[model samples]
Target chain A: MAQRPTKETKQSSAREERPPVVREKAPALAPQRGRPTLILVGADKGGVGKTTIARVLLDYLAANNVLTRAFDTETPRGTLYRFHPDQTSVVDLTSTSDQMKIIDTLATAQVRVSVVDVRAGGLEPALQALQDTGFLDAVAEGEVGFILFHVLGSSIASLDEIAEVAPYVDDADYFLVKNHVNDTTFFEWDPVTHRKYFEKVETAGEITIPKLNELSYEQVEIAGAPFSTFVANRTAEGGPADHSFVLRGYVRTWQNRIADEFDRIRLLDRIAGREGA
Target chain B: MSRRTLVFVACSPHPRSGVSTTARLLTDFYLSRLADVEGFDTDPHAPRYHELFPDRTQVIDIAAIRGQISLFDRLLVDDGVPKIVDVWQRSYDRFFKTVKEIGFVEEAHLRGVEPIVLFHVDPSETALASAQSLSASWRDLPMVVVQNEGAAPLGAYAHETLGHYPSTRRFVIGPLDGAVAKTLEQPDVSLSRLLVAPPPEMSIVIRAALKAWIAPIFTQFHSFELRRRLEGAQFLK
Candidate 1:
């Protein structure tokens, strides 16, 4: 019993003296270097992985050195604090009046990148209200807008629902991503259905997200007293995620997919000679 | 919104009860006194005083304060003979060093500004119950005992403590109908009809009371400032 008490004290002291482990800071992205603007991530459908996709894109962008700010319209359900203090994430907690001020701040942007994250089935009404209030016209002046539609494989009906609200953002890039696909049995992306969905949208961005068979996860644990600093201890002393089995597979699959989308958009940018077009 | 000069001290966000109501009504009444005023809701982003009578109004958030305090100062100076509605109460203990009471008044004088301070004191059982859990600093600040029609005897135990501050201002608040009966019936429910307008009798008493109460503290404040500036100076040992 006496020995146990001494061991406990020793452990406690060691824990107290241990230096804090700092997360690797990614460099700021060239695309969002000078101009800090608000990004709203929105989708018009429910259970469409809007929040999850936003989190993944934010993490990937931050890891690759993209400076971004996020906003959530709802309460206690924010996405900025998902990964501990990284350079790529910013969030604005503002009311309706203040949101306008934030938009005004973005107006002078030399390079402003904003994403609107909307709840599934919440896009139609929200867009109409914003348009009625003259907020969207103000926003469209200096923003590269994208409407994300996450659908299950072979769900043309779901895609059809999204298409009904597609006219509002006819000029914006509309991306149809197939999300959380763990099984390929019942749902397959038919060329016929793909063409139909394309016909519905004025212009379709690239189809990017892969099936669940392509997705990967790592067994990472959060340390620190608050259990908030969830470090992926899969990398070298301070390097990119390692070439080890799970980490490499996860990065290669997800990161490469996002990079491919970026490349596709980059090609389009070069062809049009327009950064935001 | 057209920006207007907001002459007020800064304080934390509203607590659950009296603080919000007091701040809101005080601002509303002050704005109502002016012509062509528009009022914004209680917003965390709003500046000290939005242009209630203005061409436009915008809530000034803390970020705005950090970004452009100069703009705010300019507005203050431009609104000549501006009425400063101060809401920051005596948070004496929160400071790294203890604040002498007269230090505050002298700072205002040096700054060439005098804010119309609103010291909110509610007589309801609900308000008293809140005080029981209040911080020591909050309990120590000067308090005014207010009674509306049919209101509870809030001043019964408070008068002895408040009587010490001759500068303390009290009011017999009433509903819009000039009846305290509504306030008495709903002790827990906040009474928005209670305005911050000073009672005529209290107005007559304030100046003399303030002079007597603050006289001794003025010297203490001066001494404190002197000691602060001379801390590093070499003196006769």
Candidate 2:
């Protein structure tokens, strides 16, 4: 009505209206720079507790006030979304638009960390997608921080993944996670083969997710709550639940163990763009 | 009153320290009191506990996941039935390891299940050490020191700061007479049933002696359970 405003003027006026990004007060040990972080949790095989690892990472990031968002690759019915419904979305990582939705927003998203839970058999495809989009190039250029968590199962194929995925993580943080959520035994992996893939990469880190009790694990699944929530003995909606104290303690202690590994890797520091600090 | 399930785990690292005897008597005592009770002999291979109460007791080998679910899943359920486990020393480490891993005792407390460890105090240094070690690991777990009248006295090991824990009370189980003990040792035998109505053929003197033998033990069991109920009682102020 009042002299038709130009697009540029309106955009500038709108940008002026928005408040400045108030960076969350990181802990004294956290890095000074608060750059965006991208973490990929993937496994070539199904049921390696990839989603479980991603959920814990989200919790760890959240605990450190990292301001994290997650994309569960378990499309249609995201297992990660179920536990962390408020901060997650289900997406097809290989789809063009979906890829853009994830990769495009990292530069501008309010969240400091973005976690992508790669679906079964999607690790290579997801990596290739990142390569095609030159996302790895951006990460290498130090525009943003990136991490690839290769969730390993018990099979020989899991070892083969180290060879396939190891090449791409040269510019990003690479973690080889041996998920024992299913209590898998790696009798197939001899020390020589283990050394060939793991030892060769000086930057690569190994994390062993210890075996939790069968009943406790099953109960948590049945409760359909995040590990932290389960440990608190609360329902998904934060309602009262009659969960066992012993079971909750088991989860809490186990989560602490897993969190210790993340801490040892300086995960928060890497996400905050502090390599040596 | 919320029907609390008492899960008494009669255990020892040393063998034949009267673990099964304690378990059997406790199970029998619950049955005698007309309380709903279930028994589990952790060793399926040699399920001697279940042999006494075949219909009521189950042989559960918790080494496998399936067995663990069968036992632990039910323990958390509000069945209003107390459970007594005749734990084998051979499988003691594995059994407790799994229990501690699963957080069974804590869970049991939430579900109104009281899990008490009845450590069979015997002569071996290993047994004494394990009693101290186990009580330390399971600090929140209710413990009772069982002194088998047939076994050696714990001496310094029974001291509060050393072998025996602070909260635990002492129980003297047996120095049973040969003929009387033989009668109770028979398969499917229940001391409670015998005490209530001894067999017609059983001599009055033998019956009286059997009742007398079990008197202090049963009193200790009742008193220990009452004290625990008073301690861990969620409802009663």
Candidate 3:
């Protein structure tokens, strides 16, 4: 410039030249309808019974007559899909197209509640993806509801995962789950350390899944049916099943106990968009 | 019309509180009528009820899950066969807890099975309290208090105390002559067998006394069954 530009002018020009932080736009709002809820169930470690928690959530939602659809992000084959094939789809949460399939249809889907079962060691990435996709923005703006069930294993490292996932869930309903379906003992953690990690997310709550009888659990797995279906003594095809009444009784008792835990947490109220209502 | 199956649960929390005696009476009563009946003896250590009716009864350890399935699942079959269970003193708490948890009573009703808890009332305050507690908690279940005068007789005060229970139904068993009571306790002596075919060595006097002692009790059972059938008919109507 013929007249040497002032420092303030140069700074202003540089600021104006910076590119904008681009974000995918939130999906269009449904016409004057109830806000859709998305529940993400995941764990940092494998074999932590996170999938079992997802299955129980589906059963619980169905029991409460909540119209719910589920996405199992376990690649091409999802365990939740096997039990509840009618209402579930297998998807890859990392893929942009798959994420669109879930996010874009939120307002248009007939079912208002969606459960996403994140694969093991995928919670951080999944949460990061939600942050990047403007889905979390939709949650912040009250256009959608978000819930995170951070299923924890019995180890100190599980606590670390909680801190990592805590940032993305500040505006969401967060729960830490201790699943004892397969394991018997909950490893003792130093109270101070435990409190430190737990307090990282002040609003997070704890849920315990009681241990079910081994034989009963095995029978349910073998039947390849939902817990409620097995308890009803029905096959995967909705036909009469010759399941052992003992195993069915055990499953019913276990399922009822899990339902009690859900009730204690007011899960129905939270998921139905009726909290404090 | 199909008859509703009856499952009589003879239970007492105290040992020697006439639980086995009540179960035996019910089993013998059904057997004498030629009704299809099954008995479950929940006494893991001493299965006296099973021993008394080996062909018709099975011993089950109700503390275990498998035993619970065997007892409760079979009871729910509703095959029109009357069922009797002699719940041992040690297994009493576990038994009722499981029943409540499984909602066995309501399911039994839906399946055309009526479970009647024949609670043995002794002279002890513990017995009275247990009965009162059960009456308060299990209002849906039909409970009958059985007072066996031979084993655990209640004095006037104890009887008056038991009268305060919410249960309106009460059954009295025996204040039998010493000899009749002793003879009935013999392991080989089955009341149903005695009624059907008395042993040759048994004297006519004792047999007649036994018949006199059992006639009114059997009549009581018959009346109860008639009333239940009428109730079922009314329900269907």
Candidate 4:
């Protein structure tokens, strides 16, 4: 029989093999002089559940009594806007006027948090546009609070998107979200490769969205209501609806799991300015 | 005020723990009262409860979406009919998990229904731990610990441990002789029918034994009903 290396030994050996990376400190939760927080949710790949994450974030914020507004960059037919129509506006992020509608009114708007659901294949371009508009500069200068939830697909290519987004988020709260809503066997990246990419952004955190029952997810999609509303057995009009109790239960469980993950990361304390309180 | 609709969930994590027997007894207890009662047999493969009460019980597979909808959706309907579910060991975890996730207890209360768990006590340590876990998880929900001596007689240690759980009440099913137990196992056996009108073919000695076994259990159930109604009245006052 052979003796297995202890966790400490393995960690020390790995540290000796790899270079020590410079880690960034956490940002002040209460933004510089109460600047509103902006969260950009995006993935280079399509069908990675960007809107779903945005919707869950909106729900979490709403449950915590944080006033939030969302912008769906999918243009004329935004999926996020359909589910959260009251506070979401469908816009083309490529257009300057819509960008102004989101960025220019950040401090003036009644909403304390702004969530932007960037379209597929739009992450790099979105970051570039933000850099061109000097929003990244403002974040770097501590003039505003920024959080980028880089939703990742289960592909090596998705890891490549992290490096591209890292330089822009040096001062932002970057999170790599592994969404398992559609597929359970996700993120088959080699540990070394995964660590190498993660090391690109030292302040980056990982959040997992657990798999939800397909039927329940589809039912919520068909109902066109928020997750909380579906769990409450209410229709889009706020009246009692006849949704299946089993499906509603599954959704409620899934939402609670996501909420737990958010709470674990101190998401409300991080972005809602709750730390000061 | 009218009596609140009741939903009795007979459950155990291990097979041969007298879960089905408890469910059967509850179903018959309601039937003896002439109240409208429905039973859900979660074991679609071996639906003994449904077979016994085919007209009143529905066979449901709790693992499947369609079956879950059929069971839970129907349970939410407040038409004043009581429901009893025989949670097969294979479906027990899913059944309780779904109930907690859906917030069924609270919603059932709001709809004028009370959900009570009839946790059958087996001699196994697993059974004792599971009952304690359930009691801790749903502290507000009413639970009744059922000690079925004929199925799985509890040892002193197991008995003492289960006694500590915060159960609303304890119902003990006394052991029956082998002949009577075998006779009750028949698919067509109806306790209510036996108490109301014993068949002529049944031996007088066997009839006497069956009556002695069932009458006290029914009396306990009746007393529980009276106590519940009294509590409701006091709440109103």
Best by lDDT: 3
Top model number, DockQ: 4
Q: Supply the TM-score of chain A against the true chain A for every candidate structure.
A: 0.59, 0.85, 0.88, 0.84
- Whole-model lDDT values for every prediction: 0.38, 0.78, 0.84, 0.82
Q: Answer with 2 or 3, whichever has the higher TM-score.
A: 3
lDDT score at residue A63, model 2, on the 0-100 scale: 74
Among all windows of ten consecutive residues in candidate 4 chain B, which has the lowest summed lDDT? B159-168
In model 1 chain A, which range of ten residues has the least summed lDDT?
Answer: A221-230
A1-277: candidate 2 lDDT, tens digit per residue? 1122343443354245644323243222123245678999998988898998998888788778878889999888999999999999899986899998898888777776899999999998898778667787777667777898989887778767766665566678888898887878665357876666556554547788887877778888999988888877689999988776556666777888898999888887787787592
Q: Write the residue-wise lDDT of candidate 2 on B179-207 in tens digits.
A: 87787777855687887887787778888
lDDT of 3 at A177: 90
Report RMSD (Å) for each prediction in the order shown.
24.3, 11.1, 7.7, 6.8
Each candidate's fnat, listed in order, reads: 0.00, 0.21, 0.33, 0.75
Give residue A37's lDDT in candidate 1 (0 to 100): 39
**Can you give the TM-score per candidate against the true fold?**
0.37, 0.77, 0.87, 0.87
Q: Which of candidates 1 and 2 is the stronger one according to lDDT?
A: 2
Residue A84 lDDT in candidate 3: 93
Docking class of 4: medium
Q: Find the number of clashing residue pairs for candidate 1.
A: 28
Steric clash pairs (candidate 2): none
